[model samples]
Target: MTLYGLKTCDTCRKALKSLDKVEFRDIRSDGIPPDVLKSAYAALGDELVNRRSTTWRGLSHDARAADPLTLLAEHPTLMKRPLITDGTRFFLGWGKDVQADLMR
Candidate 1:
């Protein structure tokens, strides 16, 4: 199982702490390698970018209107943190519901 997220993310930390065999990969520290980013977009399409994030919201209207690929290439933080993925399964955020799904 592999987890893609930032170490500073509390939810990511919590999820990691709950697991004993996770192959943790800090996307922020390691940086979202182009291949992984490409796969993320391939797996979820444009939805990979989360407009609800504060990072996205902080963008100006013009910036917010930018294309997803452009946004992802320029500002990946807008794509939600703690994007935990267990190869086949992918979780967008940290919460009991998501945790339950991932833990399964």
Candidate 2:
């Protein structure tokens, strides 16, 4: 399994600590793989973009209006935190539902 998120993200840290033998890819440094990003978008849809992030707030209205996939590709930090994939399915965020799915 692989966890794609920022190294500075606390939520990512928590998830990383909780998951054993999982690879942590800091999006800022390693950059998300194209295939993985596409798979994540397919599963999470528009919800993949983090509308609540500081990066989102800074984007112009036109930028926000652009295609979600384009926005995500241009600004990776705009992606929601801790997009965990077990190579088969995707789990976005570290919410209870996601925890229940991944913790096992």
Candidate 3:
């Protein structure tokens, strides 16, 4: 399984700590290669971009409206944190609810 997010991200850290059973791969440090990021997009759709994030807030309205692929290609930070994937299922963001499911 792969976990795509910054190690410093609170949600990512919490998810990791909460679910000790799973091994995770931090995409921020490993630097998700372009191909992988593209595949993730394909899997998760544009929802991968966290519209509520500070990074998203910094982008212009035009940028937000632009294609997510273009935005992600240019600014990978636009992606939501804790992008967890278990080869088939893709999850964006982290929360207690997800933790419960993941832990189970």
Tell me, what's the RMSD of every candidate? 2.4, 0.8, 2.4
**Residue-by-residue lDDT tens digits, candidate 2, 1-104:** 99999999999999999998999988888878888888889888988999998999999998899998888888999999999999999999999999998887
- Model 3 lDDT tens row, 1-104: 66777777787888777665566766555656677777788987868877887878998888889988778767767788787767677677776766666667
Query: In model 2, which runs have C-alpha deviations exceeding 4 angstroms?
Result: none
- Clashes per candidate, residues 3 or more apart or on different chains: 0, 0, 0
Q: Write the per-residue lDDT of candidate 1 for residues 1-104, one digit (tens) a residue.
A: 77777777787788789976888777645656676777777777766787788788789999988877678767867777667666665677677887778677
> What does candidate 2 score in Cα RMSD to the true structure?
0.8
Return the top candidate by TM-score. Answer: 2
lDDT of each: 0.74, 0.91, 0.74
**Candidate 3 lowest-lDDT run of ten:** 20-29
If the candidates were sorted by their TM-score against the true structure, best first, what order would they fall in? 2, 3, 1
Instruction: Output the lDDT of residue 42, model 3.
Output: 90
Give the residue spans of candidate 3 off by over 4 A: 21-24
TM-score for all models, in order of appearance = 0.73, 0.95, 0.74
